[model samples]
Target: MPDNFNFEAAPFDTLSEYERNLLRSALSVGYYVPGETLIEPGSTTLALYIVLKGVVEERGKDDQLFAHYGPDDLFDVRGLFAGQTRHAYRAVEESIVYELNAKMFHELCERNAPFASYFQASLAAKRQLARRDGQNLAEFILTRIAREHLLPAVEVSADLSLGEAARTQLEVGADALLVRLEGGFEGLGIVTRTDLMAAHFQRRLSDDTPVGTLAHQPLAVVELGDFLFDAMILMTRQRIERVVVRQGSQPVGLLHLTQVLSLFSTHSHVLALRIARAETLDELQRAAETLDTLIATLEGNGIRLRFIMQLVSALNEQLLARVFEQSVPAAFRSRCCLVVMGSEGRGEQLLKTDQDNALIHADDISSEDALTWMAHFNEALKGFGYPQCPGGVMASNALWCKSVSEWRHELQTAAQEGRPEQLLRLSILMDAYPVAGNEHWFSSIQAQLSTWSDQGERWLSDMALAALQFDTPLTLFGGLKTSGERLDIKRGGLFPIVHGARILALRKGLMVRGTLARLQVLGKHGVLDQHMADNLAETFELFVQLRLSQQLAGDRSGLRQGLDVSRLSRAERDLLRFSLHVVKKFKQTLGRQFHLDTR
Candidate 1:
């Protein structure tokens, strides 16, 4: 038995002697020291390193110290099968580490079901972190107790003023600079040339303003040791043009938009432009398909799933807007509104889920021709890859293709006295995003929805409660039960979290599409407490990661690419269980938050 003891004993401790013997035969010495590079980021590291003594500090080249590894913590196991190169492993002090390569590690786990069981939560947690688009590398590492490459970044204070920052940018010719704290980029911020220009155009700040004053809080960051591919995805997803690269929390270098893009498509900007200018239906379809290819390429290159979804959604929005411009008649077009509902609304359109949409035209007399033209445009989307929604919520459905007066009336009526079935079916409509047409129509809808009264809340609460009713697949043993077979990860696991969040957010009068986003809005307003919100959001992100992973798998296998209920790991089951608990709390919270319990 090892002398080092875990405060929370892992399942490994429960293995039978024979199982331990099977595991022990291939075991390398359990070892590690502090302040050493245990597994450098970017190398192919396929092994489990057991720490025998000394704490290993997980430091990114950016100088960000994330997690501290203690005895018995498993390191690099994800890398063993992740197919991605090792990331961020320079120890903080002298340490000894036992490295078990893939084959031996597999045998040991195969020999001990308990040891393999221990892996479920670890894998689920890592994959969830990986799929979160904008979480800093430090945040990512802290959770793993495991993994940076330093990137180029500039150090600036958060107290700096926009104008002062602008002067520094002009002098240095830097498009952006990173705000820094003594420990690292934790408090670091980025100031871009555009930010400077915007500062110049907008009034109300002095020249002597501190350079740090203009720093946007939590300026997104990249560690020096991170893969360029990861950095590129973050830049795109967060819509930032540059990232501060740091070494061990020190701003060592700066990575620009150009450098980040080099790792993505040959030129996303060029493709975006081409998509914007494409005129005909055939050209738009081709552009949309090209977007799929771009996403597939990005996915293949190990770009994070959240980032892929962001780019695909952005590309789609641009393409559809162009199509709207081309198809809608010019005169009435200015008064109409086109929107995307459902997953696209949440910015979570992984692998082309069906289109959930509706259109709003002007209140005044409209031509049947215009409606007909709109119907034709909806058909065009099918060729472009958005399947006609099975529920018939698209603009082509006469019930949904209404004038502004009709839409406002419908929403008000729904709020005042809509049927539960209607609310359930039309929840997506409430989250509609205006891709094109009348901006005013969107604003009107948004305002009315936000001001929804007690009656509205009741409808929303019931809808939310209904949505939250999905039983989390967690068993009484806190385990996920499958048919002793692979489970449909989506049905059993993800949809519960997502749909629950959706109903609650709506009940709270929130319009944000992403669950993470909805939680942010709701949490701020006291609808969800901080811990519950964080857990709910994390659970949803976990669901997205798993569901998307399966979709990618099915894509590779040439399957239909719908949600798969099976094929989850044990760790994922744990996460899903955690998520269900989160939902239970949410359901309880929803009852309280909306006065359902009191009622």
Candidate 2:
């Protein structure tokens, strides 16, 4: 075994000292020269090779490259299990590898469950394990309340004097005291030291005043087993300093905002708070630019794409609202509503893509005034790192920003005409989510559109038919099919699922904007089977994660150039294949439901 073999990487990291010794005992170093074949196709498998240095390539017949293996990369586990090589492995350059004896490898697998499962687990499971195996010092979202050090709540009777409660708080070094509610009330209430000070100074309350009058109720609380991230959201939303940690009805302790923030100091909520506090465009721009860095940090800390999206979505909305409030005149802003469309509206945006937003103003508002306000709003966002839509689908476009009646007329006309462009616009508009101003204006227009969709099956079919625009990027025998070695993930995987989900949601008149949420609602209402819905949701999440990985690696082409297939790991490639198959299945289901062929 080489002295520098990375025991901290992958399945090795899951091993115990006994298993490490077994691996070391059975490991032998092997060296290969450039163009030299390490394993010939169809030959009986020998040892498992982990690259120690240089490069190795896995090639199919005619020397077609599938993937490249570098230092710390393990190869041919499938071959070792099956006892035959499906692909030939050759050294791309001078290479050194540590070959573990096959018998010893199997013995280690038999001895260890996690080690064995790493070889046989599904792609999703493999990804999760791989993340867990990485640097986990920043992974705090899964931290349960019981796992962290919490402040003890000094429980006091409601009838206790304020001075005594204040004395007890000081003696116990507690910032807040829990008060048991009187008059047969079952829940607890809370009074902070600030409350005591305010009562003493502002109200000139007597020291003998009952703490019950000072305690705020009903108290905001989180369960003992709740994820700390959710607790943070609760506190942030409620604008509180602390929440009582409870096990069912019994109070356990107090978790403060400061305590949660200490672990999640660089978390998304911090960015949201920054955006919320920014009163100027320059201030907002400075905060918005760091969002990409934040995304990378969160991903590095092993956060899942769905949660990342959720947090980013909320932050982006806050940033947009701030932009609108600052850039638009207060008088004019009251007469209109601002909305984000497409992926942004769906709350599925991971990286900052193009601006797909619009304005819906009151019919009586002057168009000239509204246009001036929206132009500044759009430019403010562009300065804040949101790129303008290449298709001009932003609020600045006259076609998108319009009065209520104008929006209604245009939507009705589009529904009646059903042109390709009109269909595209309609699909985009279906996912519109109000970010600022009069949400009622956006809802009224959206409700009318839904009613229009209900009036005709032909229009709904036309919309659903667009979902099948691209073929799944898969070969007849289940291998990946790519253009110039790149797979357009948005076209092949994301579009089909998103559009299909949208069409179904529209058909049922469900106002939900998210693709996964729509699928859940559809499944719940029997429009889609629960099993299929769950599969599609998982598949969609995998596709989004894949795209985000590419984006994080500086492939900012986003929905344009697609994912570079050659850059994917074996597990990622397998997941991509599986997800594409799900897209195919989902498209077929949509086609059957919409009667596309008859059209």
lDDT of 2 by residue, 329-360 (tens): 88777789999988999998877889999999
Worst 10 residues of 2 by lDDT: 129-138
* Cα deviation of 198, candidate 2, in Å: 6.3
Best by lDDT: 2
TM values, all candidates: 0.60, 0.75
**How well does candidate 1 score on lDDT at residue 346?**
72
Off by over 4 Å in 1: 1-257, 263-267, 300-302, 365-367, 483-492, 555-566, 591-599
Off by over 4 Å in 2: 1-111, 115-123, 133-139, 147-224, 234-254, 332-334, 405-419, 445-453, 556-560, 597-599
Model 2's TM-score against the true structure: 0.75
Writing each residue's lDDT as its tens digit, candidate 1 over 306-330 gives 5566667776677778778777778
Each prediction's RMSD over C-alphas, in Å, is 15.6, 6.0
